[model samples]
Target: MTDPASWPQESASLAEYGEDCVKQWNNVSLRYRMPLRGFFSKRVKDAAEVEDLTQEVFLHLIRRARGGPIEHVEQYVFQVAANTLRDWGRRRRARNQDAHESFDAEMHQPVTDISPERVLLGKEEIKRVNAVLRGLPERTRDVFVLRALEKKKYAEIAVMMGISVRAIEKHMAKALAQLGSVVDKAGEQD
Candidate 1:
């Protein structure tokens, strides 16, 4: 692991959000690129495109890593990579006219088709949800979105959120309990 900076100022300086960072990550990408491509190609059965997708994954990581702080650098990088794969699945399904929507899309999108009446109801529910999320001691919103929105696995979320799988389960429990009641109540009425 790299040395942790003493302060945000010092850390901020280390922000290599520059050409060098992209180059560095690209090198790393090449190292793992083939194996990763091979692995995904088997399932997706698109060997030719896998290489390009692998490069895209690293490119995205480079962009995001440049934008801001990453609590666990390695973990965050891989999580981003995994999500890229999930996004591919979503696109492919949409292309094939598959009925099953990817969890990835559902989780990323905010509740849509909200009617005025529903919004009024959801207003309080949204507040309650915000409150519930805010009540969470840590980054509950992020964790919840990654798992629920992105449909990312616990291990992926844990790495991205920098929490343990056990902790991720616990956080989701509280998050769902609070938010679920609100959603369930809304769904029950008419």
Candidate 2:
């Protein structure tokens, strides 16, 4: 004899509930897993990833079912599978974009020495410029070399030389004008 409220009520334990959901998912998912695998295989090359994605679909169904029994299991499962694939696509796009960014950085610093002849010509030009620079007045040569070879800004050169930016600019102009004539003479020699 038991009170009406205390009478044995039918309710599955958590483990039993989970097992029931898994069994149902297994039975229903078998029919669709092949189709889902085929669908995933078209986009993903690795069979293992396809299989893993398929299992993720079932896992999603199991988690969702834990909330309550789904009324339309097939439709729900397919929808979840589609969402999983979309998520994978988004991740792959982000990964590829990151890879392309690294590739672009490398591309910006290309190995410009594509030919030995170009290398030799560049070296010769540098030698001629060095000879011309040596012939310049000490102050002009220092200013020009700092600005050109060392790639210092005019303001920086001014600070280092204890001169004004305007003075550095004038020195650069005079250096270029003199180098122009020197380059012309060198060209004639060549």
Candidate 3:
């Protein structure tokens, strides 16, 4: 068995470890590269990602060997490979990569129904709504904006406004009644 103390330290360059250490490391890498590729290929679907993961495993092994000699090189390599795969899985999940869809220009084109008449009608409706909202009491308007635009629950809005949930419900009811009347009037005009 070789002495662990003789293994390369962080301070020692790979060249200082002599050609034999380099050759041994190269041999170990070559022996394990194909197996590591197979290991990654079994789990990852993307060919590029599998190759990148296989390379990452060897990088980890190199870093570990630089720290000190591994007692069981084969076992250590596979362990690192397993850990690398697990980390990759965690990253993929965090990024929500599984839910992503590739974009195609034809499929993602902008809607063609935005005619000038529709746009002008939308603007007039927004102005009418804004005028009504402005005429409302401050608290009622605030409750309306918080619930409608911000999508806050009644309890959440109550907590935020330092009011009771019942008060929140009352305010929301009043705001909705006023808005509903405005919508009815607008429909009559149309």
Candidate 2 positional error at 9, Å: 38
- Candidate number achieving the greatest lDDT relative to the actual structure: 3
Roughly what TM-score does model 1 have, to 2 decimal places? 0.36
Distance (Å) between predicted and true CA of 61, model 3? 0.8
Expressed as tens digits, the lDDT of each residue in 109-131 for candidate 3 is 98988999989988999998999
Q: How far out, in Å, is residue 153 in model 2? A: 2.8
Across 59-84, the per-residue lDDT of candidate 2 in tens digits comes to 78778777976754555656888899
| TM-score-based ranking | 3, 2, 1
Q: What is the lDDT of residue 186 in candidate 2?
A: 60
Which scores greater on lDDT, model 1 or model 3? 3
**Candidate 1 — which residues are off by over 4 angstroms?**
1-23, 69-73, 97-190
Checking candidate 2 for backbone clashes, the offending pairs are: none
All candidates' lDDT scores? Answer: 0.66, 0.75, 0.82
Candidate 3 lDDT trough over 10 residues, lowest sum: 9-18
Q: Which candidate is the best by TM-score?
A: 3
